[model samples]
Each structure stands twice: as C-alpha cells, then as structure tokens.
Target: MKINKKIACFILSTALIFTPFLVNIHSYAETTSIDNEEDKREQEERERQEEQRRQKERDYYVAVEMYSDFPKLKNDTQNTLTVQIKNTGGSHLEKSKIKVSALPGEISLTGGSSTTQNIGTIYVGNQTSVNYEVQVSKDAKTGTYPITFEFTGNYGTSVENYKAYSYSKTFYLNITKTEKEKDKSQYKPFLIQNIKHPAIINKGDVADLTFSIKNPNDKPMSSIKVSVSPDEGIVNQTQGVFVENNFPANGEKTFNVKLFAQDKAEKKNYSIKLTVEPTNPTEQTDSKSSEDSNETPKILPTSTQYTGIFYNAPDKDEVDGVKNPQIIISSYSYGGTYVEPNQQFPLTMSFVNTSSQKVLRNIKISLSAEEGTFIAVNSSNSFYIDSMSPNSSVTKTINFVTKPDATTKTVAMTIDYTYEDTKGTALTAKDSISIPVMQKTLLSIDDVAQPQDVMEGEPVNISLNFYNLGKTKISNLKMVASGDFTVQGENSYFVGNLEPGKNDSFSISAMPNDPNKISGVIDFTYEKLDGSIETAQKKFNFTLNPISPMPDNNNMDDIQPPKHDNKIIYIGVGIAVVIIIGIILKKRHNKRKKSQELDLDE
Candidate 1:
C-alpha cells in the first residue's frame, strides 16, 4: 500500500510539473497570434527551440509526409501524388533522394521501379516536397494500396563526421483506375557487393571469414541468421548470437564466421553450405506491431546456398587463411598542438602493421588533404617502404605548410596506402587524421581609459574595450575584474560567443581601501578551437590616496597650532613704548619753556 501511494504521488507530481509546459506549447501553437514581424520572429525561434528540445536524443531523422494531388480519380484519368520529406533530426540532410515502389500492374508509378527523384537537401525542422507522376491502370479497383518510400543520403554538420543513412517507410494511397504511362527506371541502388577475401585454410588452423548481408526488404528485419557449415574433417567454430537490432531497411551490414580445420583434413576443395533466414520482421501496414513488445515466432521463407568453391591448402611453404594486414597511424605528433595558416610544421607519424600472422611489403603511402590545404615542404606527398614484419612499426617525418587561405578550422588529412601480402597480392587502404588549424586569436584591447586621481574608499568607474580581430570566433568568453578593491556591481561578465572582427566592452565600479596604488586585472578568457583555455589580461593601476574624513576636531591625526618666541615679542613691545614716552616728554618741555618766556616778557 505504501509503494502504491508513493507511485501515485510521483505520477501526480510529474504530471503537475509537465502540465504547464504542455499547455504553453499547445497555446502557442493554437492561440498565439503573430501581429508583427517581431512576433513572427519570436514564434520561429520558439518553434526551433521546441524542435531541438524534442530531438535531443535523436542524431538524425528524415521522415516522409506524403499526399496525393488528385484524391477522387475516375477511370482512364491521370492523377499525381506528392511526396513531402521533412528533416526532424539534429543534423542536416544532403544529397537526398526519395524512391517510391508499389505492387506492379494494378497501380504503377509513371516512372519504373528503378526511378528515384532527387530532393537535394533538407535542413532541420524544414521540409522538401517533390511531385511524382503516379499512374493507375484502368482495370484496378478503388481500394487503398501500400506504397513504400525509401530515402537515402548523408547527414552531418561537417564533412569529417558526415554519415550515410537510409530510411524506408510504407504509406498508403487511394488511387482510382487510370490510363497507363511509364518510363523504364534507370536508377539502381549500389548493392550486391561481394568483398573478395582470401579464404584459404591450412591444416590445424582457424579461419575467420566475413560476408556482407544486405536487407532486401523495404522494412527492417530482425533476428537475421547466417549459418555456414563446413565439409568433413573441418569444424564450424562459429557460435550463434542473439541480434539486438534489426537489419536496417535497404542497407547492409557485415557478418563474420569462424571455421577450424583438422590437421589430418583432406587438402581437396570442400563445399561450404550457407543458409540465411529472418526470425521476425517488421511489416508495412496501417497498423504496426509494437516493436518493444514480445513477438511470436513465425515461419518465413529461408534460402539455402551451397558454393562448391572451398578453402585451399597453401603450398608446402606458405601459411594460408591469414588475416589481412592493416596499416594504421598508431601515434602522430607535430611541431605544436595547433597549426596556423601559412605556417610550416613537421608532422611525424608512426605506421604499424597490426596483423599478427602477416608481413606486408611494398608499402606505397601518400598523404593528401581533400581541399589541398596542406602542402609538403620540399618533399613529395608519396613515400615508399620496402617491407615491415608482423606487429612492426615505422615512423616517418614530413614538413608541411598549411594553405594561407584555408577556410576550415580543422582539416582532415587522408593517407592512402597500398601494401602487398606475402603472396604478392596488393591490398589498398585509406586512413585519415584530423589536425587543428586555428587562426591566431588576436584580442585587441582599446587603451583602457584610466580614472582621474582616485581616492580610497570612493567608487571609481573602470571600463575596458576589446575587439576580436582574428579570423575565427571564440566561445564561452568571460571577463573578470579582480584586485585589491570592492566591485560595486557584478565583477564578472560572460560575453558568451564573440564573432570575428567584432568589438565589445564592459565596465565596473570598484572601491579600493589601500592608500597606495590600487591595481586590478581585467582577464578575458575563452575556449580555443583545440578545446584549450586561453586568457588575455589587461592591468589597470591608479594612485588612490586615502581621503581623510572631515577633521573630527578631536582626532589626533588633525593639524596642530605652531609654536612662537615670546621673549622677542616682549622686547619689541617695550622699545615701542619707551620711544612714545620720550616724544611726549619733549613736547611737554617745549610747551613749558614757551609759557615761562611769555610771563617774563609781560
């Protein structure tokens, strides 16, 4: 009861959390109205985001949305069917081709069964439509019939990781009887590839043989079994395996089987019996069986093939049934981790023959790039090796220069080589290695505008200007200001992605406590193309004198009065007084003498 309650609670919580998102999506699709260009743009962006979120788990998917132009057709009338293809995958589909096939006679396509119309390219969340002139025979009934559509193409964001894929789906169409018109199909799928293998078996040896098994059906077939039985004196060491996935529709996969021969086995040719069958398969219809549900085993058609060609015993000296020799780039090195445009660097590579039982000779190696972005420096692109023993390796170094105008940031160099086996049979193989070519990141910082005499404990505005002057863009660009100061607002800013030849700037207000020079570093960091972190720093320094608070009138740090000499001041004052007294006495004496002379005269 507790478990059941917990499960119910969990379900309720999940529904509650997701209900709003569902409602928002529904409302946006059904109710939202685009009143202006901005609204339309926002709708497009939201749709793109929603689609990307929905396809997060799928790498690439191309689906078919088919419809017919003429729904109601009369006898001896012409009709057209329209095939629409949509790319809902994570990547772009290029060089796409769609082919339609149906049961012959009653209803026939204007183009023969071999016809395939080119749809070009379809971007993510985009659709491409093509019209096929479908014709129906006048004797056909008016019921619905199944028609299979096959799509094949390459998909990826870049050339290095592009992969080939094919999708086949069956859609029904209701077409009335009409006059017949047809053109023979010149389209042929690349199939029936019998990769030649040296299937020779010496006595007392185990041999592993490989074969390409293709699914000829329009739908995926599961539990495909390929059995190989050897003649007398030989043992089939191949064990049956449970396949986890179905054979891709209209595609092929390689399978391997091991065989062992007894020491006393006859040297004559032995007929090997081959059998193939599918346990359960997907069928095209209006309804489909649940792929994840248990399937009941049903009797299906099986093919039994016997090839009289048998394993041959090598001559008395040679060891047959040996695995093919493969040359691989075990380890490679260059002058630096990244190469710049028009820069010369030495590329050293070690080639190893990985086969244990085979020694390869006459190795002709040639290194070339698809775009010819790399050119050898004073050397040829091809090299020759006399021979290499089993499990042996040889290292060679070559100086090369990158093209000055190479557009790709990362270039793939292909190594095409051919070596001869012990029997002098020449085998050719191709290998590739990726090299990172980055344009020098030139982050130019406009002269940082310094603040006027800064005062401690006061906020000062500091701004920086920078530009990306390089040819490549940078990602996750972050700017940080750190020093002996307090930033008023955000000290760190994320610029996200910066495009080439783009300019940007940021500002921050910082308060310093130090009385001396206050210094701060504005560091800009971003991820390089090689996934390495690089940083460019701009240092800003200013003299910040402590701003004394308004004199507290009692604080000891305030200015004090100056001392004076009191003795000198006293002497000067006494002299001034004596001179005034002498002047007064002289005046009194002159007045007295004048009065006595006047009395004597009377």
Candidate 2:
C-alpha cells in the first residue's frame, strides 16, 4: 500500500511540473501564429494603399467655374466672360488648350484676342484662368443657348511619353432681346445751308460774303456766335468774328462776312471755316431782336475747311455789256486717275474760254504752292499758253507732290494767267484748284509667333508677320528686333514690298541671358511711293523660365593638384649655383698645390 502511494505522489508531482511546461509551449505557438496573421494583414494594407496611389496618379480631374457680366446675354451687345479651371488630379499638366465650341447660330465672338487660348501648365491643386469677350448676333432669337468648352492636354506621369487627355463640358447661356443705344452727343443742332461769295476779287480788295444758318433741332438756340476765318491768303475784316443773340428754331438766318484780301494773295481758293455755338440756350424772350446784340456768345470750332475764291474780276465793256475774259476749267485728271500722299503725280488741267467777243493773247499761266505742304515738282511757275481764239480751249500739265504726313486732304493751288482782250485791254484772271491726296499704305503687324517656353540661357526663334493693311503698296519694308535679349542671327530682315492686303513673314533667333520678364519691340520701317520712310513698332512680352542646376555628386578620391612652392624652388636654385662655384675654386687650389710641389722638387 505504501509503495503505491509513493508512486502516485511522484507521478502527480511530475505531471504538475510538466503540465506548466506544456502550457508554456502551447502559449508560445499560439503567439507565433497570431504574429504571422498580423504581418499578413499589414502587408495587405500596404498593397492596397499602393494600388490606390497608382490609381490616383492615372486619374485627371478638373473643376471648372464660369462667370459672366450679364445674367442673360443680349443680342447685338458685347459681354465679358471669365473661365476658371482648377486641377484636382495627382499629376502635373502642361500645354493645356481650351476653346469655345458648339455655339448656337445666334452667337458670335469678336474681339482683339483669339477664340482659342493656351492655359499653360497646371500643377496638382493649382488653378488657371482665362478671359474672353463675347458678342451675339443682332437678329438672334431669345432663348437658351448651349456653349461647349473642350480641354486637351498632356500630363507629366505618362509611361512612355506625355499621355494626351481630352475632356469636354457644356454650359448654358440665357439670351434676351436688347437694343443698343446711341449717345446723345452724336446729334447735331445746326445746319449750314448755303455760302455765297464773289467769284472774282482782286488783291487788296474787300470780299463781301453771305452765309445762311438754320437751326435743325426742335429747341430754339439763343446767344449764337458765328466765327468765319480763312486758313490762308486772306484775313477777316473784323478779326474773323460774328455774333448773333438768338437763333430761331426751324428758321434760317443770313449774315454777311467781309474779309480783306492781302496784296500778296495768289490766285488760289482760300479755305474759310465757320464755327457756331449757343450760350444761354434755355432762356428765351420774345422781345429779343433778330440781331440779338445784348447777350454774350459761345465759341465753337468747325472740323473742316470751307472753300472760297480769290481772283481779279473781269471788267465789263459798257457799250456791249460783254465781259473781256472768261476762263473755266473744262476737265482735270491725275496720273492713272488716282493721287496718294507723298506721291509725285501729273495734274493735267484743261481750260476753256467761253466768251463770244473777246480774243485772248499773250497768255501766261503762273503756278504757286502752299509752302511746306505742297511742292511743284516738274512744272514751271510761269507757264505760257501762247494764245486762245474766242470760244477756244487749251490744256496744261504740271507735277506736284504732297507732304509725307499728309492724310486725306485737299492741297490748295493757284493758277494765274495774263491775256490781252480784243479791245487792246490787258487783263489778268486768277483761278485755283484743289488736289485730293489719299494715304497710300499702312503696315500692320499681326500673328507674332513667340516661343511657348522661353527659357533663360536657351536660344529661341521668333517670327513676325507683316501685312499691308492700306489701299496702296508698301515698299522697302524692314524689321529689327530690340530689348532684353541678344540677337543670335541677323538683326534685320529686308522685305522688298507688300501690296494691299498682302502678308509677309520674317524670323530671328535670340537668347535671353537672365531670368527676367523679357520684353521686346519689333521696329517696322517702310517706304512710301515718294521715297519717304515711315516707322511702326509692335511690342511683345514673355516670362523666362530659369534653367535647372545639375545635382552635385562628389567623391573624396579626386586628387587635387599640388600646391605651388615658388619660395622653396627659388632657394634651391640659389644653393645649387653657390656649390658649383665652390667646386671650381677647390679644383684650382689643388692644381696650384701640385705646381708648388713640382717647383720644390726642381
């Protein structure tokens, strides 16, 4: 019995000790299994996050917002529009393009800018914007119109090359009917009916002139002042001043103008300009006289010149009542029937004598110019016409040139002739003619091609297109570039000529040295028909992107050159020279010792 109990106790003790050890082993195994499961979960989470990041990189998202000035667009009216684009993607985009499309039939776009625009580069979470001016047709219907905007571009995270992406969005616009209004200041209140003057007046004579003025507006104008003045050749008798107190509405008033003709006044048509103004226009009284001499007048100036005549009037024969000389211009023409400013052109004048009893003799035609503005190029100032029979006609040719800066203007000229009448009376008759000068040609620059990416320290080619936007031809056109950059190629390009509405292009290579806002001007010079030069300029601006620096990767083993020791080298050279002198002296001393020993032996 005792033995069985001992055995039981020993087995129980062993079981207790071993049972804890087995439990520990089981707990260890369980912990390893749990750790492995946690590692697997963590790995799956990392892979999922990588996949999500890759998906985001491949996606391109953009948020768009449109703004306009009017809530409803009106026909025949101009409106401003703004477009805002926000990048919501994970990559950077470059060279983005946007254009307005899918417009309704009632809509049209016109402005100084183009319809399509380049939005440049947009980084992730950044935005870009554009502005445009929109116009609608005058006869557009009132309704809802759809406007589509399309975006096309490439991204930086492409696999092989820049991947192209295209997106389109449509926005609606409400259209309404609206009429454009004109400015009230554009309406004129007065009208000039007729101006009558003597057809012939001699030098140092007073010219009696009559002019009629009518109020064309509904309201009556008071305190009216009239100013009639000559541009050249004559002066006003009363200092070119006239005043009227009240001008009746819808009624005409006639005033007489007296001007003093100068002694040096050539036979020319003078320009008389009339100016009118109203003072105290609202106040009116019936007691005001037709001459309204009580009120102060307002002064206004006319925009253009009025034509008048200056000449020596022909004497009338008392018995026959026949005028001695009568000269009239039958016809006139410029070369090729056209005249341009700065162009020397032939002006042919045909004169007719429409007199019955007068026989013309000793006829000499004299020409005078309006100084500094017009020049007589090829004709004599005093031309002879020989003689003209009664009721006969003759023709003469002269060449004249207008000023280079002359616009569409009338150049005044004088024609004076001396002749003897049939009754042996010497008479002088003067007449004037105006030549119309037109602007020949104008050069305009458009479609200038600047580099899309103007980077600092890089060469870029720039091109400019020139067009002859005028009615005539432009000659000797040249272009030169200036500002901010060094011209890599030829600085100037010579284009021979450009016809009306013709186009030509020139190119130049340039490089910017510094990172700054690069601005430049292209100077365009052209020649007119009369060999005069004119200049026009077009301006351009762009930002220069700086070049990226190379990364630094250095190592310690790169041996540097030995430091120069000029002082040590100089000292070593001096020591070597001294040792050579000492060796020569020692050799001479030993030779002398040998010579002394030989003498002792002798």
Candidate 3:
C-alpha cells in the first residue's frame, strides 16, 4: 500500500510541473502567429498607399461630361445639348471657357450668335455645365455629323501638365432619310446690297466708307465685324479696326469704315476697301484649333460668305454683263497615295466647272512636271475635252513614268486650262497637283566595331561605318551611342545629310564604369520618304575586366631573394690583406729567429 501511494504522488507532481510550461508554449505560439498576420497586413497597406501616391503625381487633368436631348434628328429640327466639364485633375482651371462648332451649315445654334462661352473658374474635383440649343440643317444627308467641343483654360503655373485643353469628345447626331432634298446647305443668306463712300480722298485726309448689308434669312445674325482696306498711295485709318453690328432677319445694317489718303496718294480713282467675315453666319464660329496643334487642316469645304469686300479694290473684267465661267481641279487621286520610283502609274483627276450658271466649251488642258522627275508616258501632256454643260465634272487619267534617279519628294504638276463660254469669250485658269513620290530606303552598316573585351576605367574607341545603299539622299541622319559608360568625347554624332552611295564612319570614346557592365548601342536615325523618323540600332556587348594593377607583395611572397651585406664583403677583403701581410711577417720573423739562435749558439 505504501509503494502504491508513493508512485501515485510522484506522477501527480510530474503532471503539475509540466502543465504551466505547455500553456506558456501555446500562448507564445499564438502571439507569434498574430504578429505575423499583422505584419503582412501592414506591408500590404504600405504598398497600396505607395501606389496611390505615385498615381497622384499628375498636376492637372480635366475631363468633360455631356448629354443630349436627341440622339437622332430630321431636317430643320431643333434640339438641346448640355455640356458639363469636370476638373478631375489635382489643380484648378482659371478663366475656363468652351467653344462649340460643326460643319458651318450642317448644324447651327438657334438662340446664340457666338460659339464662345466663358466658365469663369473651375475648382479642383469640381464640374460646370453649359447648355446649347442646336438646329440641324435642311440639306443634311443621311449620315452622322459630329459636333466638336473645344475646352480651353489654364492651370496656373501647372500649365506644363495642363496648358490648354481641346476636349475632342465629339457629340454625334445621326440623320436618316431616303429621298433627296434641295441642296440649300451653304446658301448665302446675307447680301452686301449697297455701298456709300467718297469717290476720292485728298492727301493726308481721312474719309468714311459705309456698307449696307441685308440679311434675307429667317434667323438673326450677330458677331459681325467689317473692315475696310486702302489702295496704293492711300493710308487706311481703319487698318486695325472693325465696325460691328447685328442684323435681324429681313433687316439691314450699315457699317462705316474710315480711310485716309496718304501724302502721295494717286488722284486717278484710288479704290477704297470693305471686307466682311462669317458672311451669313447665325453664330460666329471660333477658328478651328486643336490643343496640341495650332490648327487642324480642314479636309472639306464649309459655308463661306463675303459680307464685305475691298471697296473698289480690283474687279474682274466682264463681257456684255456676263462673268466668265470659272473652272478648277476639284480633286485628284492616283493608284495609291505613294508612287514607287522608276515606275509608271496613272493619275486620275476631276475637273470641275465651279460656275453654276455658265457652261464651258472647247476646254483644253495642259500639264507640266518638275524637270527630270516625271514624264508623260505614251501620251502628250495636253488633253482636249469637248463641250460640257453647266456645273459639270470631267475626269482624266494620265499615265506618268518617274525618273530612275528621282528623289523622294512631293512633286508639283502644273495644270493650265483654257475654255470658252457660250458667248465665245476665252477664259484661262491654272492649277497645281501635289504628287507624293517615295523611294525605298536601303542602308548598309559595318559590323559592330567595339572591343570584345573591355577594361574598367579605360576609354575605348568605338567606331561604326555606315553607307547609304539607296540611290536617293537621306537627310537628318544622326548617330547616337547609348550604354552604361562615360563618354570621353561627343557621344552623339550628327551626320546631317548622307548622299546616295555615301559612306561615313562614326567614332566615340567610352570608358567602362563597372567591371560587370560593359555594353553599348549605336542607333542610326533618319527621316524616311514620308517625313517620319526611323531608327536602326546595332547593339554590342563586351565583358569588362578590372584594370591590371602593380604586383602586391605585402600579403605573401613565395621566393625570398638572397640578402647582400656590404659590411661582410668589406671585412673579408680586409682580413685577406691582413693574412697576406702576416704570412710575410711570420716568414721574416722565422728567418730572424734562426739567426738569433745561431748567434746564441756561437
């Protein structure tokens, strides 16, 4: 019984002692696990914040929001469009404004006479709205028309990021119709009915010129500015000024312009001037301009009006109260946009009689090209056309062979035409066509001339040989070296121009900065035939070994050189001399001693 009690007591004591240790181990493990999870969460949060900070580096950017009442429209229908411009950038927009425009006659505003509207100021992360009442033209075709909105403003000194903005978010409207309608899209609704001015102004005297303009359309016109110009020997007092007025529908408005005769003004009917702009515009459309570019070239014609003219400036001669028909080259096209060198291609063109009332008869057209660039193939440069009715269009195709050594350029071809009206009055006009020619680029370059093995901190001369393989010259040729090294001289070599079959060598001295990194790239950049820049790069790789250093004998030496002692050599020589002297002395002393012994014996 006693042994059993003792064994049970020992087991109980062992359990009690290990229980606290096990609990402590579990608690410690749980704490470490919590700390790990927390650390992971904190790292993730830091990464997210850093990403947000980098994204917020933008100084300014403004976006636009728009809505329209009608997505589609019929002829002569009116609608409303609301534009909301938002400043989503990190800065503010000062003196902001918007301009709305469309094809001059395709769409117009009903209640406005100016396309520009100011939106004073827009704070950061804010928005502003503007409204417009738009009307579709009666002569619109079955197509989708775009309404351009241009937003312009400044971002204070942050103009680098947001100088001026042209939000090209075009609002489109679809026009669906089956039958054709009358072409009244670009009709002139305003007329310069009368002009009142002094017939002549004396020297150094200013005169007033007035123009009476009448608006026949149903809409009112505003934003009209008129100016007058002067002729030879005459000074224009209104040179930099304009007379502005508004003319209601079926109403008349007069503009008065001032002109001053110069001191040497001519007396024989010096013609005065009067000029008008936006002739029949219901609203004055701002000039088309893009933010990135000064102005986008217009690809299509729009409604144009001459509200004013240079009064008595110059006039075309008329025969029997009939103006001669005007003929022009409407458009032209070729096999494609580009013509290969030394190849024959057909150029198709359309000749249009611009006069709606007069007919052109017995039209003779002649063509001429640049010297040695193009030649008419199997046909003369002149062609004849028979009688043509009023507002008629004719097409002619001419085959042309380019010169074998012709360069890449836009060659201009002159077209001179002579035609007669119904009254047999001869009229002549001249036009020019731009023909774009392209010559394929062919270039050869020498192999990479950089050293295969490079040494750190040492400058190596890298050379590249390039030759123009094409027959045409290449302009704006440049050579640039890029790598992880320091350049000793000019790293970029401007070749400027390379003639056909011309060869040139470019060299640069580069010093490798790191032992592990030694590589370079030579890039050849030049403008192609189409005026687009192109680059051809040749990459070279080399291994950099550290520069050779003087021998370091401090750490350890294998063979020790024999040590020399000048004192020992000197002492040995002295000892040898002394031995020779002593030998002689001893010999002499022995002879003397023998003599002394003999003398003693005697």
Clashing pairs in 2: 201-311
Arranged by TM-score with the best first, the candidates are 1, 3, 2
Indicate the TM-score of model 2: 0.32
lDDT of 1 by residue, 1-602 (tens): 64456545655675687678656654553443333345658667866765654443244344434433325433455567677777866677888898764544555556553468888887777887777666667665533345677888786666775667676665544433232332222111213234333334545667665666565555565555666666887776766342525556677776676677766675455666666655443322111254645544233355565543234343344346566666777667877767888889899999977667788999999999768989999999889999999878999999999888776467899999899998899888887777878777667887557676454455665777778887778777888889988765457666667788897666666667565666888888988656679988898787755565455232233233453444445456556755765676566556766776898899
What are the per-model C-alpha RMSD values against the true structure? Answer: 37.6, 28.1, 33.7
Clashing pairs in 1: none
Considering summed lDDT, which 10 consecutive residues are worst modelled in model 1? 182-191
Model 2 lDDT tens row, 269-374:
5677876655434433322443666644322323233756645433445437876666666566777634676778777888877565677877878777555456
Cα misplacement distance, residue 192 of candidate 2 (Å): 4.2
Q: For each predicted model, how many residue pairs clash, with residues at least 3 apart or on different chains?
A: 0, 1, 5
Better of 1 and 3 by lDDT: 1
- Writing each residue's lDDT as its tens digit, candidate 3 over 221-323 gives 4445555555666665654345444546577776666666554443334545455555333434223233444533222112222222122221156566555
